[model samples]
Target chain A: MKHMTLLAGALALSTALTGGALAQTELSLWYHGAGNAVEREILVGIIDDFNSSQSDWKVVLEEFPQAAYNDSVVAAAVAGNLPDIIDVDGPVMPNWAWAGYMQPLQLSEGALDGFLPGAIGKYNDEVYSVGLWDAAIAMYARKSVLEKHDIRIPTLDQPWTKEEFDEILVKLKDSGEFDYALDLGMADQSEWYPYAFGPFLWSFGGDMVDRSSYTTAEGALNGDAALEFGDWWQSLFTRDLVPGTSQDMADRETGFIDGKYALQWNGNWFGIKTLEAVGDDLLFLPAPDFGNGPKIGAASWQFGVSATSDHPDGASAFIGFAIQDKYLAAFSDGIGLIPATAEAAAMTKSYAPGGPLEVFFGLSEAQAMLRPVTPGYVVEALEFRKALSDIANGADVADALDAATDAINADIARNNNYAPAN
Target chain B: MAAVAPTNQRLKTSLRYLLLVLVGAVFIFPIIFMVVSSLKPDGQLLRDTASIRAFLPVGDISLDNYFAAFKRAPVGLFVFNSLLVTGITVIGSLFLCSMAAFAFAFLEFKGKEIVLSLIIATLIIPFETIAVPMLMVVNSLPSIGPDGLTWGWLNSYQVQIVPFLADALTIFLFVQYFRDLPKELIEAARLDGARWFQVYSLVIVPISGPVFATAAILKFLAMYNQYLWPLMVTQSEQFRPVMVGLQYFFQLNTAWGEVMAYLSLITLPVLAFYLFLQRAFIASIASTGIKG
Candidate 1:
């Protein structure tokens, strides 16, 4: 009889465990890293940990390719079937938030204190999303090339002045040792335009739009500083210091590594590969100051809760759990991006102090500038890209800048200034 | 003089053969490139792009890319999904569109000309203009599935197949072909106490092989290459077609060899379908002056 009673007790415990497992709520997460094997493995690991860590929520992931992710999310939003959690690009978060596709994230207080500013997505004074890593751009050059050319290597505190950088380009071109002096990656005609070149305009004391108002581009994109930046940009093509808009993409990928280009302005994602190729001769220098302090465009992809989610708390919990330092380090090591926090960076193989690509961490901290943080940035980025392309193709700087400014102003007016002042 | 004439004829024949071979090479080079590149590594494929080597099957060739491509995405699933959707839609489109064409061509109906004109007019309206409205309609549609009733057809094979089963182009192809058929065939069948459906089945369809082949090939290509509509409607990866699956290869740094492998795999169905019906399709084009 005692043995029979013990058997009944065991059955009762098993039934209770099954009941608890069945009661766990499922949360769907949509990611934009569909074909990346490393990202998939790390994310699946996180999901497994999160699912087992709590009985209240079970997160399920759906991944889309980065190229098609935005369209998929927008389509889902239109169908009123968006997932509980969505991964959004940092610059694009404001637009999605304004469109009611996303809601402000709920996390523990002071959870983001040590995070990089660019890694945090804030709009209308609310945190809509947070990223695990940030990306930084640098002037990629071979130390041997710089030493042979008698060009002084620039540091974070003492970057090259505008005239010094221009002179170096001329010197490199005059040597005839390379096909081009600099590779600005002109072949990438997409977001690379604004993401890489916008900093040049900012360093020249111009901006895509007046950040204070988020309402107009007047006197910002078409100002004297912008025209100066544009003229310099055009000279890069007309003077043959850089390739034009019609540059071949194959050349862009292989030219710098093959010694056909003296220096390449590229992101840290390519740093490891270039380091592997060039060994001890590679250098990642700071961007030229251009009169203003040196700058590089910032922000990367981040996670947020969907506005239509039935369980925002559960989605936020998963996002908060994902931002742990270990996961951030894993992502950095996997994707070669700068970790969002110093602690995370220290744990990463590439971003840690004394690491080969460690300088990118300092660059991100010191020189990274967020793209115009407003819903109108979407239109602003496109116009800026078009204006930059036009200038590279020899359009009058002032005329092209004026057209971009007018276009931005018109969009702002059409949208009732995106967010009107009270 | 006769000997000289024979020599001239030989010269002209040689010249004609040369021109035909040149044209054929121009058409076949891209397919050759895709298949060849699919067997090479990414670095070798890219390096070969600037030279004639791009079109040749030489140097560091292997099937590693095809294996990697399969591992990266559900290549088999995507191809299967595309084939199933395209097969069903093509068969249904042939039956429904040909029947509609028969009514307009033979059966007397009220306001048929206006209706036919309106239907044909849709051919001019771009699909992109109507995609959003069509998406809205489909999102609100009801379907009977394993679950007793589902409210929306957002992520289903039926959604991809149904809206495309009776396109204006297919209907117009059938209508033009049916109208060109001898009226005496249909009249004789009707006089023999055959009904309208019987005349359509017995007298018209059996002799419409070339048109059927023509319409079937055109519709197959259109359905196989569908990207935008399926992208908007099918949210589940299980239901996505090959065209949308192509985006899976385009990451931050695209793997060109894998992309070529996926392309080569997807093109098999299209090439096979066309080759199977090329004789009839070519005959149809010759008689109707319609080019695919």
Candidate 2:
């Protein structure tokens, strides 16, 4: 009975895909954008165009807003009511992959090469998801503020040494033009902490766990470099620059726009909003690569095909089309973010008659660090962020790191015991 | 309660009024913020300070957000789905629960006490614990009539309404109310050669207006506020309830003005219903004893 029911479901899915009326394949795509008017208008037009361009398949667009996209998608998957395509973040790919929610794409035919080398690995051995946008982390500083204070930021191609970065912060502090020399959103441990601060630990040559044993009882929190970085991060609070609201949850964008923050640590996705708010006053630079370790940045959004989708072929083709040069260019112009494919970089330049976007894109390509693409990475990332936040608020560094390590270790044991390929 | 001097009582009453006003303002602050913020442009949603100067927007308030929200999704279809699913769930739950309550209260049956215990026991088990299993059960059922003879129960009004049919809490409430009824009246009706079903339909049901009203109001609110289950069952906006629709609207659109407008729009129906039913609830309460 179950088999027969599943067979009927399969038949129904195929019919839905094939546009049962036209007998053309119909595929439903789910995305969690539409935060602003620009994204909503652009995405709708793109889907409509995709639907009209084909005779064999018509694409249906469904949106889950960023706020509740994760919960909604998980619920949809549990109910076996998944759309043909979904836009999942890089950190979430492993969770979906391990849970058997994503379908592996047949990308052996040179299709995988179109993406950055390490990008596909985030989705496990099989190419389970395709990169949508380059959400590389970078710094945005107010050029006018920096210039008025006679402070020059290090170039996009150059790495800022620990001494140089500190010197600049000290200089800004002394200048008194801004309330804080930098606003990295340190107080909001749930979000800004892990992504903004995790790279610092890595740059200091510290690992969250000793990969050899992968056990919390035998973790890497005792390492000297990790403890040193933890203390340095805590200093931001000690210095009284980290703003604390009733909940210590304040918006970084608001701080920057109001001229309270001289420098903002965020991803490339905010480029358009920053531009719209402050215009040429914004200067883009790579996330400061503190020497002696790898530059760690975030890999942002990706598109995945649902395991239940009947139009995998057309969906895959649409994934390719969705990131095409023209659409990417137009989207980049409208949203001030990098295009998915490298080819769209040229178009991005053409769309914006400015230097910052291209400079930021180049820096993004060079220093981007793919966040750990493990199942349940959100839990781990969040715990790690909490450790840093605790340290920032004067908690013992060793204890905080130990607590985070214990949490991530437990998460790994429960969710992903699979030995990693890399 | 304490007895007070006349002057002290006057002071207490004034203080009570002041306290009520303060509490009311505190409760309504967020809603007011949402409404006012929605009127402002995107940039002003999170302004640093609120002053009388900034209470109203500088630019003209526009209905563009509402227009954009409707154009973005099928709002009409959503309203129809909400009406259909909520109406069916409310009505179906009322009838099934009342009948089951009547049987348990008045009829003789084997292991009646144990069965009643089990039915009530179901209420104690938190729905969260069984949500996964319950969803699997719902998904497993075909929405169409038996064996492809009709549309599978899924994505259908019945599928959306059926699982909600047997609510234990509702049954327990109805059973308690019906058990208190004067059995001689039901006995008299049955002795007149009326069928068992006829007694329930013609005599008992007609006299159970207050209890019926109580059950209907509770079910209506539950069905109206429902979000997750309806979202799971309905594949299209054409089958979504109001809460799910409004939530999706808020998610897709961040411009506060549009969100507030849509919120204010959807909230009216429930608000109106509540105002209409307030009289019924009050009257029912006035007549029923404290225990009932």
Candidate 3:
């Protein structure tokens, strides 16, 4: 009986030790890169590192497809089932934070210092999310096509002026060497509308919403500058200088590569593929200057802490650990985007100095601009998309802009101008 | 003139066949394109879209995209999850809904008409309208599982299965079909020593193949094509279905070839299922005039 009790005590002690070794608190993370094997592999590496590198927390990943990610997160938030760590789109981060789906990140004070401004998700003076890389848009063109046409290759400092870019498109169209002068990716009707085209509006001194007040888009969207931007935008389609809204998606993917389109206004995510196709002749030019300095849409997917997380520190710790320069470079190498910092850029194969995709890093540094940082920006972006789609289909530019302005203003008023919490 | 009439009849038949072939082509072309595209490189697949070549199995053809798709996502797991969820839901729905229909049709109950009407009224209310509320209710429901009595139902097969077992549309389909069943069959069964349960199992279910097939197909399609609810509820990849898995192919630079390959793979089960039940489903629709 005594021997049996001793054996039981030893068994209990062994079980306790095993339990203690497995006591790392599990922190759930939801990511929006479910199908991207390269991204998945690199991210799994980061998660595994963070899990093993610490004693207090172990992060578990749940990945959703990017298309369904936002709605899923919103629904999970409604059910109060949001995971501890969530990755959000950079522009949409404000809306999520406003909806109380996310909390301000709790990384160390200087952790974000060397990161690109676009890589940092800031709203109301607090950073709520941080991305490992920033995406930039550029004019994808063939150097040979431009040189053959005798059009001067523009630099970051001396981007083509609005008038020069317009004339170049006309010249290319008149040459009849291509089916179209430009492919604006009109087939993609989602956020691509606002992300790629909004920068043109900004260069024309117009915006989706008034940044100073975030209350109404009256002057910002329908003002004289906006009306001018809209006219130019519609003229591209009406004149057949660019593909219309009904452009086939397949055409958008292959037109430029097949030499059916002379140029494509696309993001850096396609930089590597285009480079492989066009080889040494490919160029990533800056967005044209239209009175204001040249600009390209900035920011990409980013990681943040969910507001309901009972373990914010652990969630933030994982995020902080994941953003180390090596990991950032790994992500950049795996997927072609601008690394978040110069240090990380130096570590990447493509974004490194004198590399093939080095120009994108420079373009991102010199010209990248974040979309309006407000909760109302989501509604504002939707209205902007509709307005642009209408204009492309030959609606009166002034009428489209005015309609967008009213809808945006109404939305802002409906939500009490999306007042921020102190 | 008799010869002319015969010739004209032949001409009319030829024209009808031509129109039928055209309509069939219109429906079948997308599937053909998907299968053909899945076997080609992304570049060739995209290039072929402009011509009749897209429908042909010519040029740079291989199963590279399908292989890449598998490497990219756990395609088999997604298919299994979808099939399992769909299979269980269809079986459960057929049984429970048919039983309810049996009771409504054979047994006299109080407020029967009003109750059936209420259940049918739910058909008009979109699932999206009540998705969030339903999500909350499911999250709070108690369940005994491997963990031994869990409070929430998130990230589990039962979560995907249980809430969908007896949706209103499936019940309505069963009720409509059961009502149309000859009352004499029920009367004869009751005149025997058989109980109501025995009649349902031994008699009504056996002769009700057409309705059962129709309901099974409708339920299977509905459950298999579920996107929003699964997206909202299944946070873990292990519980995600094929539709949600389809999203994995749409990165910033979407892999069109991979998307087509995934679609082709997921579509096989649906095609096989429909083909299996199509004869009975058609017969049911012809008799009942109920369009699914």
Say which candidate scores most in TM-score. Answer: 1
State each model's C-alpha RMSD to the native.
1.7, 7.3, 2.5
TM-score of the B chain in each candidate versus the native B chain: 0.99, 0.79, 0.96
- Residue range B77-186, candidate 2, lDDT tens digits: 76777777777887888889999998999899999889999999998897667766667777677544456544234466666788888898789878877888899988
Question: Candidate 2's residue-wise lDDT over A1-422, tens digit each?
Answer: 99999999999998887565486577898877633457768888888788777676778877654655676677678778889988887767877877777887644376655555434545545777766456566678877776777766667556677777777777877677778878776544445555667777777767555544444423455478787777777776677554542232235547787787778776666666677789887877766656654364656667878888887888887776676667767777776666665676666652243546676566555766665656656776777767766787689998888888777777777654644433
Cα deviation at A390, candidate 1, in Å, is: 2.1
lDDT of 3 by residue, B264-290 (tens): 999999999999999999999998898
Q: Write candidate 1's Cα lDDT for B53-155 as tens digits.
A: 9999999999999999999999999999999999999999999999999999998989999999999999999998998888888999988988888888998
Q: Report per-candidate DockQ.
A: 0.66, 0.20, 0.82
Winner of 2 and 3 under DockQ: 3
Off by over 4 Å in 3: A1-20, B1-5
TM-score of every candidate's chain A: 0.97, 0.84, 0.96
Provide the global lDDT of candidate 1 against the true structure: 0.93
